[model samples]
Target chain A: MNAILECKGLTKSYGGKKALSDVNLTIERGRIVGLLGPNGSGKTTLIKLANALLTPTSGEIRIAGMKPGTGTKKIVSYLPERNYLNDWMRVHDIIGLFRDFYGDFRPDKAYDMLKRLNINPNDKLKTMSKGTKEKVQLILVMSREAELYLLDEPIGGVDPAARDYILETIISNYNPEATIIISTHLISDVEKILDHVIFIREGQVVLSSSVDEIREQGKSVDGLFREVFRC
Target chain B: MLGKLLKYELKATGRTFMPIYAAMLIAAAVTKLISALTAGGSEVPEFISAIVYIMILMGMFVMTFVVMIQRFHKNLLSDEGYLMFTLPVEPWQHIVSKLLISVLWNLGSLVAAFLSIVILTFDEIANRALMLDLFAVIAEFLTIFGPTGSLVVLEIFLAGIATTVFGILLIYASIALGHLSNRHRTMASLGAFLGLTAFAQILFACLTLIPNVRVLQHYMDTLQESLQTSIALFHYVMWFTIGFFTLLSAGYFLITNHILKKRLNLE
Candidate 1:
């Protein structure tokens, strides 16, 4: 299988403290990969590096055989940990903006997702609750026919119902041939959709295995996470 | 891409500035009506003229510096920056869009404010045939400056305007830089501003100290000479202004590109 994303000895540091260190990861095409880690485990940092949002301090990262840059960013749809959508924009305007910028953005698909969530097209982002805003952001990201989707904390801070809806939207909307890398601590909720999982601890990759293999080994991904992250 | 970027830039800026432009026109019309009604009615008070001048000057000042910079910063650097940087456009296009928007609005505000003052002082100005003579003299002066001098003067003026826009973009870049950190986004923005201002001031001081750095001084001298021959110094200032802005613009582009490429933290 061809790897859509390959990071070799990736390292990042903030001042003297390291965020990611000597981390190597390879994600193949057509796989839903879970980037599992605790707080400050560098999941977001890794996603940022892959998305070209942050440059690596050292080591190399390649997205679909190209260095992380404008070219790579064009093909990678990123859903950041926090709400990156401007609160001043209405849902329709946000859709328009996405369509304007991303040639592959499917506005009808986005509208369908919004409708499914019962989000009004004319509603301003500021009027929506945080969970709804998150869903809106997710819809925008998933609406793109991108090669790689990097979702950081995709279901964070939402109720169980909203979380299920978000996961459903993601699973239903994503291109089957594309890759999705979801970084989150909510492993139990996301485990079912993930084909592969990488467990990171203190900025290092502690474990990487397919969910089927781990389950065949008579352990749930969450149980394995607890075993690996036990401190 | 540039044309489209600029079109959107202008639209974004216009949304904030159209109201101000309308207000200026209304004020001008009111001033003209008042001046016409009061002309030779009972000897208009000097205080009224002073007030009009002050109002026009105040409006021009706000438009040039406060309104223009604030709008540019808000649209291009604030939270809206996410939308801007992610637009699949180059950093240069972003800088150019903001620069052009600033220049267009600056010129528009100036014209609007001048028209207002003209309306208020129309009687006095018309009685002296100032506008007609000024235009005639300007035409004659342009002929004397010749195409080369005219081009040089134009470049210089554009450079100046470019410099102001570049300065504003640099400020925006600094804010983006500060946001990369985990703490003190506001303080970092302020620090970036102070640091950038100090850096520019020092650079300017150094340039002035150099005897051969004559572009600005030479342009200023030519402008003084041009003014005597009936040409307004506006064009000449704009030429060097463009040059100054071009350099600042380069800096702005570089800094913005670096930030967007490297330390972009959406949160």
Candidate 2:
């Protein structure tokens, strides 16, 4: 009941094909959890359900005791897998949007990050490169001081060096009182940062355990993930 | 929150629309300049100006509808839907912000078109004559229908607004339905639109038939009285349809909200 995120018997299907089924999970506050899975294995699906981007076919998902709704939306900082900012918007305009909509959003923090990254506030999103767009999205997502952060594929599109920078950003901006659920396939890159890892495949969790426990078992989360979801 | 959403929505959509609006006004100005330069000779510039003027008017009309759909689908149902629906605002507020701004822009477009026309044909004597003629006709209309005619005008205006809302809601509901599809979303939306239009046509036809054939059958016997009575009945029917449309728009809004809130399957 005290968990920041709870999903009970959550199922999502599209046109009779099940993307996720009978997902029962709980994420406690103040931990960076890795939601690791192969492509099309429902990592994004669960994250989307938590963010209310997609609704459950049955059962329910609750973030902070409330159902996925405008209320939960207020406290859930979501970085969708796609580039969601309007192309016409300037970098600062979107930053302003997050600030205006979310009371927890810190504009000063956002500006600092953008300035450090050398992204001009006046540049339109369409003018930025693909990698740069992802960075901007990350900045916007990290600037919010929310109770729950749902990041779907946060580092998927970036290069190796950019991925490190993004990880650094997530680490530095990590809110100890807030839970962070990061869904990504690059398990090794995030393994060191993850306190816990949920191994999901074929729309169900095969393993949910602490990173220490996995390491003590003489296997990295990445190795176990390969073993668990091997083709 | 709704105000903030409106501000952002307007800012996002204005970039697309303002340029077109400015082009329309510029076209109007260019047409006037061409007329002045031509000075009633060399018909080529005038002919080209007329085409440009007509094209700008048509472009504005078409762009208005395009911007409306883009605002709803691109902002709320496309990839950007990720950002939009995640905002701490309710779905109803989303609808209201878009609807209120849409109505405002619709009126703005109308005013812009009017101003463009006035600019294009701004000869003082002719405009004065035109205004006088328009007022004289309205005065005569008021004289015949008296207080009832005023009521009719008000009802017609209300009905016009209702129809615009109904059209927007239909598009919105269709877009919501289309989002339920996994692929070919544009085609799906078009199909939804056509399906709704078919249903609406049948409903309105039934409404028109029931009154004209059955309800007003008695008044058909008197030729002169039927004219006035028909006008009166038409007035009543306008109000009735307007009420029906309002309910339909509300229903569409509820459907759209349900899709966004509960059945949302964003791609």
Candidate 3:
């Protein structure tokens, strides 16, 4: 259970281009790990594989010693990068859907967050602005009492103000035993909360270390990211 | 888990279909009322209302087809797959839930159309006898076969359900196959559906050319013989039809589930 996610030589390719190649990694529980990478750097690919949205081309990725399937999905809550919410449903109905499908989902907590954000539960998703929809999706994900939370670019699409609120919601909601992997190129905004970071570039893991380790070397995660992924 | 999936699937799809059904029934009622008012007068108003009824009928049919395809593609193969596929439900449950809901809507559309037609034609005096006569004829036809008669009716009902399930699964299978391509998914899905239809036709043709001719000759001969032989033969053919469609539906369901589980790449 300590290694919440373990990838053993995981490889995934699209057509002839490899998204991730023979990668091996382990993410432990009870830590906020930043899957830090530039665009098209295989961060999302790894996340999708973990979520069972896409199967690996070869090798294996396991969650809590099990392959990605219904069992793992029960413990994993995902906030995808896109607006996956249907335009037809109200926020209340969508919350009901989450509560219906995921036993870990907490509708009361979701409603409370919506109220704090001034989002009406009765409002249809289509009428909401892009930022508002993103906030709503984040609230749904954070409201889940899941063992692992996979937030794919949770703050990437929001304003600086909303990003702070989203980060605050995520930090305060997740229990100590749960792990959160926030994948984004906005490394500076998320650096303060990340206990560890995994630097990926061109579908390869270049670095996996604790924040204190980087700080001990007199380098901020943001500065280190800029230097490592410099164009 | 499957029950939960179906509950939400019904909720999501009900919004589009329920309105179409209600509109169709309303148009039918209006057509009936207009005809009753005009009774032997100018036919123009009746014709116009009939036209409106037909237009609504067309809308129902088109929406049935569109909703079946759109629900699967938009819900599972689009961005929404991020939500659906991640559910703690198994992939097959998603397939089954969507398939069951599609079959329900398909049957619902048919039932609505039938009821609308009944409303359009019903008259308290004239059609009462007509309806009774129709039922009497059906009852007499069934009585001719004795006990096997009711079994024949049941088999026919099963065949209808099997065909409906098979048809929907074919579309689901095609969509899943098309999703494996790199681009132009709608066109690819259309192609896959055409290919599957052609393949089924060819297979049926091949089967007919083989032992099917002899089976048909034997079946016809049994109709000329004793009652028991004829009943047995009827049972054989009816079961074959139901079993064949059920088997094909299972294959398509498997194809859809496997593709969605293994090769899904949502944009």
Which residue segments of model 1 deviate by more than 4 Å? Answer: B31-87, B122-130, B137-162, B169-252, B262-267
List, residue by residue over A87-206, the lDDT tens digit for candidate 1.
557899888878877888999999998898899999999899988888888899999999999898989978898899889888887778999999999989998999999998899999
Error of 1 at B93 (Å): 2.9
- Give candidate 2's chain B TM-score: 0.92
Chain A TM-score across all models, in listed order: 0.97, 0.97, 0.98
Per-prediction TM-score to the true structure, in the order listed: 0.81, 0.95, 0.96
2 or 3, which is superior by TM-score? 3
Error of 2 at B161 (Å): 0.6
Top candidate, metric TM-score: 3
Q: By summed lDDT, which 10 consecutive residues of candidate 2 chain B come out lowest?
A: B214-223
Number of clashes found in candidate 3: 0
Better of 1 and 3 by lDDT: 3
> What TM-score would you give candidate 1 relative to the actual structure?
0.81
Structure candidate 3, residue pairs in collision:
none
Model 3 chain A: ten consecutive residues of lowest lDDT: A156-165
What stretches of model 3 exceed 4 Å from their correct place?
B124-127, B219-233
Clashes of each: 19, 0, 0
